[model samples]
Target: MTNGTRTALATALLLAVTAIPTSAVAAPEAAHIEGRLPSGATYLMDVPADWNGTVLLFSHGYRPMGAPNPAQNAPDDTTKALLLDRGYALIGSSYASSGWAVTDAVPDQLATLSVFKDRFGTARRTIAWGQSYGGLVTTAIAERAARRIDGSLAMCGLVHGGVANWNNTLDPVFAVRTLLAPDTDVPLTGFEDQAEATAAAGTLTAAADAAQKTTTGRARLALAAALHNIPVWNDPSQTRPAATDWEAQQANQFPALRGLIQLPAFSWRQEAETRAGGNMSWNTGVDYARLLGQSSVRKEVTELYKKAGLSLGKDLATLNKAPRISADASAMAWMSRTSAFTGKLTKPQLDIHTTGDALVPVQTESALKRAVTAAGSAPMLRQAYTDNAGHCTFSPAEQLSALHTLEDRLTTGRWTGTDPDSLNSRAAKADPTTPARYVPYRPAPYPRPYDLAHPADGR
Candidate 1:
């Protein structure tokens, strides 16, 4: 499929120069193919001539419901070229649909693998890897489809499970409604459509923007952000704010919090509710005070409250007494069945995240570790972090280094050189031009963990 244009062009160029010997003819190049699955999801694949008996099955993150559904083979072209040059086959699918696609992604990925084997022959090893929401899909495959693959890598993933993720997102959003726009009757959940959700998001975001003008509003915003564990560092190019710099910290967190409320908490929640058949998130009986106490930015919130001359106790009391949102049992059940993680890792898994990701907080890593430890599969999972300030902000060199590390573990049945220093060193060797900053980090506890094990934590 790939030889027609290139072969003809090369032949023309060769004839223009001189007659080429028949012995000098080259083999046709590998084909890049695209096709759709029975579920209507499209997939892309690249198989090199120097096949290495290994296939890197990639899973992409969420796309908005209305966006184009194009198949992606890797996170970027550089990574794709690097892997293809090194003889690793690459393939990925655009899930059957988008927006909170956890329900369809996992199965579509396994189906893609089935097609890959049928078309390219059975691979000696298959490593599942993904970013963002796809990271959750990769981890879920590690737990549920263990027999089908060798190992997995998840970057910037929401491994804390869907229920917990939405609850954590809802906490700060609920706070924004209760504390700042108490008089505004915005539907915090059960959004009827995108327009409805967007309208609600606009109302809440305007409330947050106006609140930023006053010390009281800023303090309350900080509290709400803390409730969801939004990072104090938002801009990647700017220097990180000092630990005690309350104003700068709040200033940075304000944008991140606003973005989360508009997208994940409202707009994306609408998609999730639609897919799950009803509202699948809740904050009934949640202790906002306790949730703040568990937040990494608790001290910042307190300092801001003090500077604002706001009675922190009174605000907490008001939030505690606010009417709470409830979840539909059937919707919650659907999400749990499809999106919750059991952490029963039957194969080795490696996960990486950016330190200052606002969309999916680094604290979710702590929750993932807890789940794996509970399942007694801690030995099968290893996590690393990059000291960057955005979601999935990984360099091609860093990504190649991670792929090599997982490959080594799978080949040797032992984990080695997985430490931050070793990882950075390998990344430097992979590409000296790109910077890599793998750091040893322990994320704070997820403020409002609400999975199967921590079901009551939401209460």
Candidate 2:
């Protein structure tokens, strides 16, 4: 939170210690190394007694700007034990600072591998793996690191690209500001500081809550969620709501929806704009009618608006008539150069997603698939899905099975046991103690994906 603490994150000067238990899983016989890079990028490493010769460079997802940055070797404490006990060398960094800091995180994470090699010797293979924003970082590193990294595993990731992810979010936030709470001075693009973003999120959440009680409001909320492809069943531990259970579903997902969409992607805008040096997101040329028509949930929005006795067209007209937001050309170029993905992958990569990820919708997986196809690197990619809700809510078995799938391709020069049935079986057969829950489901492409359609056009 403090500049002093944030700066400490980039200082990587770790020391080795015996592995200690952090979760239900027993600690493995491994050396736990802790250090910081010259840039204050703190790191953590785990080398099992019988090292597997391969290292997993674990890149973590976005952390709020003011949150503490700690070295992460796994997605969770339980995962730390799993990766280490499985005989895989693991290393990660706190990444200088947090909050949409992919630019810093990518290089800091890549630099971590060098520190690992210098201290513990070079690994025979290095696989990059991450979740959420880290997933996007893994994809970027995979594209750029190329021959240096052997494989990648992205779970519930934002591989849809950097600015592409945040910029598209503006669609939903713009809808909220224009349709639901026009009077609220919530800055959809720029933020003076973290508090401004935080305060705006509170205002948007209140608006979402009030709007959910009425037909037109519900219709508008549906439109906003559709534009962002945000799922309705958002509770972390709940199953997908039945179709007739619309009220419950809306209530369940609204908080996450506002946090994810209406409030600058959980107020990461302050930090994001800082990195981009200005407003890097825009919706000036976005045609609401076209976007609504192209949306994955368009049918649902149509039904909602029809049931509300309102014309969806009129609302879209309102959006089109409202003054559109634009971006600074310099900032636009910065985000695209740094945040957008070129899809130039040189190694095999696997993406794991849950069908109902509320934050980074499963639709992003499809967008990334398109990007890979455009780059003619489709041969190097594989995707797996689970019928679950919540972001990065993967079971240990599912997680380990995904890792095995990536490692499988790296070793055999071919993919095996990656289909739904096979992957479910693999997950079921994964760790005896850590049970598995893998369901088969295919995700539809994101409907409001301007980033995927026009990589250079600011969304």
Candidate 3:
């Protein structure tokens, strides 16, 4: 698997990876197809030698707004090989555009499926799956494209609508601005273009970095992270933070907090605003004190503030008294109409998220669960978690295991062996290259844009 490796077909990738089988199982004759849609979107399709008639559509996460969209045919090279070896067809698109793409992805993916059908004929079943922002796309298809897709698997999803997700991300940035750098002049919202966004990100990121060096600054950062339910342990290479690792955890948490400033606050939100035709997130009338109290790390923040002899209450009170960010009414309307999941799931869905994911927090699962419940599709949805840090950092085994779980639910018309122990066993049996990391965990409720017309509006 050298980076320069290629096939007889144009730019066809032959994955040289450890987790994938060295050779196709039973020497199945698979058809590897690649092409471009009329809309200028590239796509890849894999029809297994066995032809099980079940196709898996993979949607990718956010790419920088201006980057070229790379056509994605599967979740990853390893997972693609595993699915192909097991006889499942795979198809996906690069999407017509990138960055905060939920607006375009839903239809683009449906179009990809349509193109797939035109080329390959009808399928017996179709499964939609994706990671990170694509996870949001997967959920959108699950709810809106029910007649076409049979089941969905969302890994490390931002299933909470664009409004709630971005607004929550703004929590820490807002805190750093209002409490620590009120006079820093960083534009918190309403970016006119990419340059303004990048500049603001630099300003906020520097403020966060400087403030994290002091106790009170750490407390305020913690408070904002809590509001967004940002996890403490963010590096995938590191183990979970122990109770005694409070400072170590905060140290680890700082970069993730900075990431919120740079990526979500600066880049993602502006892209979302482009989709919304205005601003769709607002923190008007938000009660910061109540949000802090409900956070999972309330104890830790309290400890940090106590050690610094700073009054957590005073900061909370300060936030409450300060002017809040508000969404443009038209933009709010656009986002509500175009960027949310109303649950209303017509097919089964299995969502897997990491416990300590910094980009798309584990609490996202909680947010989606409530949305599905409100849609009366609660019984149609199931969730799984892994004790991992980082965003969409699941091992290959974790990915296939979640797909298997969804397939099982679809087959049985009921959930089977879904507990952490059961899922771990299944994952071990499925993929020998890696061990299962499934764990039973429930994340805290979402903490921003507190309420909405859609259940995904708030966790």
Reference-based lDDT, each prediction: 0.88, 0.80, 0.81
Q: Compared with the true structure, what per-residue lDDT tens digits does model 3 show for residues 45-107?
A: 889889898999999988978787888978778878888889899999898788876667888
lDDT string, candidate 1, 1-459, tens digits: 478989999989988768767678887577688999999999999999887889999999878889887888799888788889889899999999988887688899999999999988899999999999989999889888999999999999989999888778788888899999999999988888989999999999999999999999999999998887778885687579998999999999988898897788888899999999998888887888888888888999999999999999999999999999898889888888889887678899999998988888899998888888877889999999998898888998899889899989998999998999999999998878787899989898887564554445443
TM-score of predicted structure 2: 0.88
Residues 1-459, model 2: lDDT tens digits:
998876666453222222434575675466888988888889999899889898999999888766788988788877778777778898999999888777789899988999999877879989999998899889888988876699999999988876667667777878988999988767776777777778887787788888988988988898888787777776666666777666555556566666775445537776788788888777777788887776656777777788899988889999998888788778877887877777777899999998777788888987888788887889999998886778888888889889988889989999898887777677777766664656666667655343433555444
Question: Which candidate ranks first by lDDT, i.e. highest?
Answer: 1
**Model 2: per-residue Cα lDDT at residue 238:** 63
Candidate 1: lDDT over CA atoms?
Answer: 0.88
Q: Considering lDDT, where higher is better, how would the candidates rank from best to worst? A: 1, 3, 2
Model 3 bad stretches (over 4 Å): 1-29, 449-459
**Most TM-score-accurate candidate:** 1
- Candidate number with the higher TM-score (1 or 2): 1
Which segments of candidate 1 are over 4 A away from where they belong? 1-28, 452-459
Q: What is the lDDT of residue 321 in candidate 3?
A: 87
User: Candidate 3, overall lDDT?
Assistant: 0.81
